[model samples]
Target: MKTIVFKALPFDKTLLTLALESGVDAVLTSADKVEAVRALGRVRVLTPEELPSLALDSKTDEEEAVRRLKAGEQLALAKGWEIIPVENILAQVPDVALEVESLDRARLAAGILERGADVLVVLPEAAKELKAIVREVKLSQGTIPLVPAVVTEIRHAGLGHRVCVDTISMLKRGQGMLVGDSSAFTFLVHAETESNPYVAARPFRVNAGAVHAYCSLPGDKTCYLEELSAGRDVLVVDASGETSIATVGRLKVEVRPMLLITAKAGERTGHVFLQNAETIRLTKPGGEPVSVVTLREGDEVLVRTDEAGRHFGMRIREDIKEG
Candidate 1:
C-alpha cells in the first residue's frame, strides 16, 4: 500500500478538494486550515509543525536523518533532495516521505531501490497529475491470468457459515472477488450486480463464500472471509483479471444452505463452497454470470490457477499439498 500525500500548502481550497477526490491518504496543510479541509472530506490533515523535517544537505545531515528515523519518528525530506541521497536514506529507513515537485520525480521516487519511497508529497500545483500517480502506485498490482475451467461436480453441502462482503464501491456486472478452497486455484465469484425478477440489484455486494475459504486481497495476500471488517481494503477484480481496490463497508456472516462446487482447469482441480440460492453465481469465461443452481457438469467458467502454497495468507514456496 503506497501512500500519497498531497502538499496543499498556503491553503488552496480547489487543491484541497482535488486531493480528497483523488483519494489521497493525507493532506499537508497549515494547522489553522486543518478544520477547513476536514469540513470538505474525511482524511488525515497534517501541518508542517506537526511532523519533523530533515534537510539532506550533507553527510552529517543525512546521518542525523537516519538517526531520527531509527528513533521512530515519521520525517519528511525537504524538496530538492538528490536521488542518491534519497536512495541512501531510503535504504536505511523504511518510512521516509519524499517531496516531489512534478509527476516525473514522483515516479522516480516511487521506483527508488525497487521498493520505492514509503510516501510521496506532491506539490499542490500538480493536482492534475495526482490521479495518475495514485492509480499507478496504489491500484497497479499486476494482472492475473484467468483460464476456462469445466465444472466437474456440484452437490449440496448442507448448512454452513457463509460470508456476504458489502464493499464501499459499487461493482459492475462482470466484476467480483477471487476465492477458493485452496490458494492454488480460485474461482471468480460474481457479484450480485444485476437485477432479477425477484431481487433488486445489489451492485455493492459480493456474497463471497464460506467462512473457511481464501479470498484474494491487496498486497498479494489472501485472507479468510471471517477476517474481513469495515475500513479494510480488498481487491475487486474484473473478468479480464484487471483489479482495483475497494474498502469494506460491512460484513455479514450467517449459516446458510451451501453447495460444494468442483471444477477442473487443465490438470488442476479446485472448488468453493457457496450458498445454495438462486442469486449465487459464478462468472463464465465470456463474462456472463450463471446461477449456481443452474451450473451443470461440462459448463465452462473462469478460474485462476497458481502454485498451491500459502503461509500466513502470503504466497510462499514450499513442498506442500492441498486438496
Candidate 2:
C-alpha cells in the first residue's frame, strides 16, 4: 500500500533490509544503480546522515561524508528508485520540549497533518492534552499516526508514578504476552498486573477477555521510547492511581484505528482510568463517567499507535468535513 525510498551508501546493506522488513511498503535506492519513480505513494526516504556511523570509514570527516553520499546515489540507481534530494524525515531523536499550553496543540496537529509527517512526537508532560489534540486532528484530517514521548527515568520498584511498560519477559519468556483473544481483539498488558485474579495463571495466556485491547513490549524498550515511535496514539492506564489520567509520563501511544474494539469485563470500572494519546477515555463500551472523550453520535475520531507504546485519538467533527 506504501512505498519507501532509501538514500544510503552501497555499504549500508543492513539499513536497507531493516527498512524493508520493518513494514516499509517498498525498498528503493541504497543500491549501486538509480531508477525512476512510478505512481507516487507513501514514500519514506532514509539517509545515512541521520543515522550514526561505525568506525569503518576514514578518520577524516570529509572523506566519510563524501563516501556516504556517493554510495547513496549508486544504491539509488541500482534499485530503480527515486532520489528525494531534500530531507524532512528524522529518526530516533530525543523528545522536543515544546509547551502545549503556549501553542494550540490542536492547531499544531493540523499543521502536522498538512505537512504529512510520518509521526508526531510530544513531551510526556503534555501527553494527555496532546492526546485530545490528536483526536481532533484525526477527526478533521485523515489518519496521521501519533507517537507521544515519556520523558522520564524508569524506576525499578514500588510502582511509583510509572507508565505501563511492556517487557520481553511478558512477550517471550512466558510471564505475559501481547496477544488478542479468539475474537481477534488485542491489548498490551502484563500477565501478573492486568490478568483476572479468578482465572488460573497460564504460562503465556493473556486475559484479553477482561481487557478490550492491550499490547506488550520487551524489557529493553521502555514505555517512553515505545510510545513516541509507535505509529498510533498510546493509551496510558494507571493501576497505581498515583497519577491522574490527565498527567503525562514518559511515552504514550494509541493503537491503530483499523483494529477492532471489543468490550472487556474490567475496563469500565472506576479503578481503570485510561488516557489515550488521542483522547482520555475508558477502553470499555458504553462507559460510565471517568471523563473520557468519546465519539458522540456519528462523530469520527483518529486513533494511532505503533508497537512502540505511544497512541493518539482524534475526534472528527462532521461539520468541518462537510464544509
Candidate 3:
C-alpha cells in the first residue's frame, strides 16, 4: 500500500487542517512549523532536512539520487519528472517516493512499472481532491480481475454456525467480502446493503457465510471466518472488483441453516456455504445483489479466481485441493 504524505510547507492553516482531516499518512512541513502541525493534529511530520526532494533533470542528477538512496537517504522525486527517468530509478530502487499534484499523476505514480512508488507526496495545491486521491490510492486497492461463474448447484446444507461480519465502515450494495471453500475461487458475497420489507439495510454488515469459510484479507491472504475478531481488518470488495479496507467492528456467530453454492470459473470449481435466508445474497454481473434463494442454476454471478495454494492464509506454491 502507498502511504500518502501531504506537503504543507510555507504552511497554509486550511491545507494543513484539511490534510489532517483527510487522513493523510504524514505531513511534510518545515522545522519551524513542525510544532504547529503537531498542535493541530497527530501525524508523522517530515522536515526538508530529513526527507529531501530532488528533481531529476540530467543523467548526473539521476545517479546522484540513486547514490543518495543507496546511502540511506529518505528522498522524493519532485514533480515534472519524466516517466523513463522514474522507471530507471524504480528499476534500481524499490519503494521510492514521488511528488504528485493531482489524482491522475498520483494514479500514474502508483502504477509506474506495475509496482509503483511506496509513498505519494501530495502537493498542497491538490487540496480540493485530496480525499479522492487518498481514497483511490490508500483504500481502493486498485481493481481485481473478476469473472462470471455460472452457478451449477445450490442445495440445503442443514443447520450450521454462520458468521456475520460487521465492519466499521458502511458498505454499498455491490460491496462485500470474497470468501469460499478455497482461496483460488472466492465468491463475491454481497454486503447487507440492500433492504426488504422484513429487514432493514445493514450497511455495516456482511452476512458472510459458514464459520469455516475462507475470507480474503489484504496483502493477498485469506483466513477462515472463525479466526476473525473485532479490530481486525478485512478486504471489502465490490462486484466490479474494486476493494477497500474495512475494520471489523465485531463478529456475530449464530446457528443458521446453510446453503451450499457451487460455481465454476474456467476449469476451476468452488463453493461457499452461506446462510439459507432471503437476506443473504450474492452479486450479479451488473453489480446487483441477488438473493441466494432467488439464485438458480445457470445464473451468472461475479467471482474471483486465483492460483489456489495457501499455507496459514499466505499464498504458496503447492498442489492443494478443496471442495
Estimated TM-score for each candidate: 0.82, 0.22, 0.95
lDDT of each residue in 222-309, candidate 2, tens digit only: 2322333323222332222111111122232333222122222222101111332122222211112111233232221112232222
Could you give me the TM-score of model 2 versus the true structure? 0.22
Residue 262 CA displacement from its true place in model 2, Å: 20
Which residue pairs clash in candidate 3? none
Q: Give me the runs in candidate 1 sitting further than 4 Å from their true place.
A: 31-42, 49-89, 101-108, 112-114, 316-319
List candidate 3 segments past 4 Å from native. none
Instruction: Please give, for residues 1-323, the per-residue lDDT of candidate 1 as tens digits.
Output: 78888888878998888779888999888888889989999899888876656778899988898898899888888777888888888888778888877778888888888888888888876788888878877666657789999999999999999999999888998889999999899999999987889999898999999999999998889998999999998888888988888899999999999999999999999999999998989999989999998999999989989888899889899999988
- TM-score, predicted candidate 1 vs. hidden true structure: 0.82
Prediction-by-prediction clash tally = 0, 62, 0
lDDT of 2 at 1: 8
lDDT of 1 at 35: 95
Q: What is the lDDT of candidate 3?
A: 0.92
Q: State in Å the error of residue 132, model 3.
A: 1.3
Against the reference, the lDDT scores of all candidates come to 0.88, 0.26, 0.92
Ranking by TM-score: 3, 1, 2
Please give the lDDT score for candidate 1: 0.88
